[model samples]
Target: MGELVDRVDEQDRVRGVVDRGEAITHHWLHRVATTVCRDGEGRILVHRRAADMSRFPGQYNFLVGGAAEVGESYEEAAARELTEEIGVRVPVRFAFKFLCRGEISPYWLGVHDAVVRTDITPDPDEIAWHAWVTEDELREMARRPTFVADSLYALDRYLSRGEAARADPLP
Candidate 1:
């Protein structure tokens, strides 16, 4: 299967310049994932990536995520990743999108934050463990453990601007 391709606009769109593979391999690609979780006060959930992951292993991170498959919508991918990673079924809402531009390739990332309440059985291949934290608790923990810098940034942006951050969330 091919990776989903979007047009090259500052915002996501369909353009004629690049093919899906080129954008993903040679260039930075756009992928979407959901941070499906809830808190201890029934507010939010947090998960940690397995320590053995190739990207950011053992990092405090989103509960579920994956690249959008060819012809798949961001919401669909988010929903699917959520189920695959954590065995949860929850409605996903568009929270934010991030661009991970590196010196080489760039990553067009869509981040959705969803609320869910259930026992999370993390896939050993994907995650190590998960927990729920209140907004205050998250703010506190963001200070210590190594987390997805982008996720923390999003949280700060959400708190400060009272609007979702327009900038790409750093990985």
Candidate 2:
């Protein structure tokens, strides 16, 4: 089993759900990733999803992330993915949440921000290309079909907040 999330109603009441396939098909799983990068620069790191990926192959994304493993919280998964995908231990502060429903996959994406001081070591199986881009550059890139919708939404939310240029350390 990959992982499962508790679907909730308007009042946040559990609706009883535990199927990844259904979650993807119906938009339910609460997955997370770290949109990590160098401190105070506000430059976002983008990655190219490997061509072998089951979903969104050869797509460009900013969050170094993955599905929340069973028994793992969103922050834990974000931290693990930051380390796993980029070789960085980032201080993951809550950034935003997204409910993405499309023909490809429906995933509840939890976006987290992390600042670090190290070079990245992307996993070849997961990432094909990588870059550190400015907000405007990312916005331009999002216009392309290769960018995932959920990630683009998340970046839009993050950039819309105007925190991308701040110098304060992530809490």
Candidate 3:
């Protein structure tokens, strides 16, 4: 049996439940939770996916998370994924959400961000290498094709929103 995931519609409403594999294979819209973990020095944590993983193996990803389970809320999935992938249990706040309509995999992504004060221990099965990099460094890296598309999209969206917020001064 495969992992069960909540199948969502274009508006991110859960319509039904399906196996993760089937959802991916059929390009069905599903719910995913992503977390951008920042360190004490204000650097974002990124990791290289393990080469043996089914999707985007050996690629760098800015966020640490996966699909939302059958009955799990976005917040619960974010925290659970953080703990499962990076061995950290911290409070993650919702940043934004977007519908990623890719050719192969389409899903509604719930983007979250958190400042982790503790150390991170990446699971070898999920991550090959990890690093903490500044925004400029991340932008330089984004120039290359090594980073995962979905993660990059989320990061770009998040960064753009930050810039917009800064431009709007408080009255």
Candidate 3 residue-wise lDDT, 1-171, digit = tens: 699999989998889999999999999999999888888767888789999998889988888899999999889999999999999998888878989885459999998877787899999999999999988988888777877876777777889887543231211
Candidate maximizing lDDT: 3
Candidate 2 residue 98 C-alpha distance from true site, Å: 3.4
lDDT digits (tens) for residues 1-171 of candidate 1: 354555344566645434556675666455545554553234566678888875567778543686676567788888888888887777777666766563335655666766664567778898887777766777787776688665664565444644243222322
**Using TM-score as the measure, which candidate wins?**
3
lDDT of each: 0.63, 0.70, 0.85
- Alpha-carbon TM-score of each model against the true structure: 0.73, 0.81, 0.93
lDDT of 2 by residue, 35-106 (tens): 546445767788899999887899988778877655566688888888888777768876666665545665
Worst 10 residues of 2 by lDDT: 5-14
lDDT comparing candidate 3 with the true structure: 0.85
* lDDT (C-alpha) at residue 29 in model 1: 55
Kindly give the stretch of ten consecutive residues in candidate 3 with the minimal lDDT sum. 162-171
What candidate 3 gets wrong by more than 4 Å, as runs, is 163-171
Please say which candidate is ahead in TM-score: 1 or 3. Answer: 3
Instruction: Give model 3's TM-score versus the native structure.
Output: 0.93
Q: How far is candidate 3 from the true structure (C-alpha RMSD, Å)?
A: 3.5
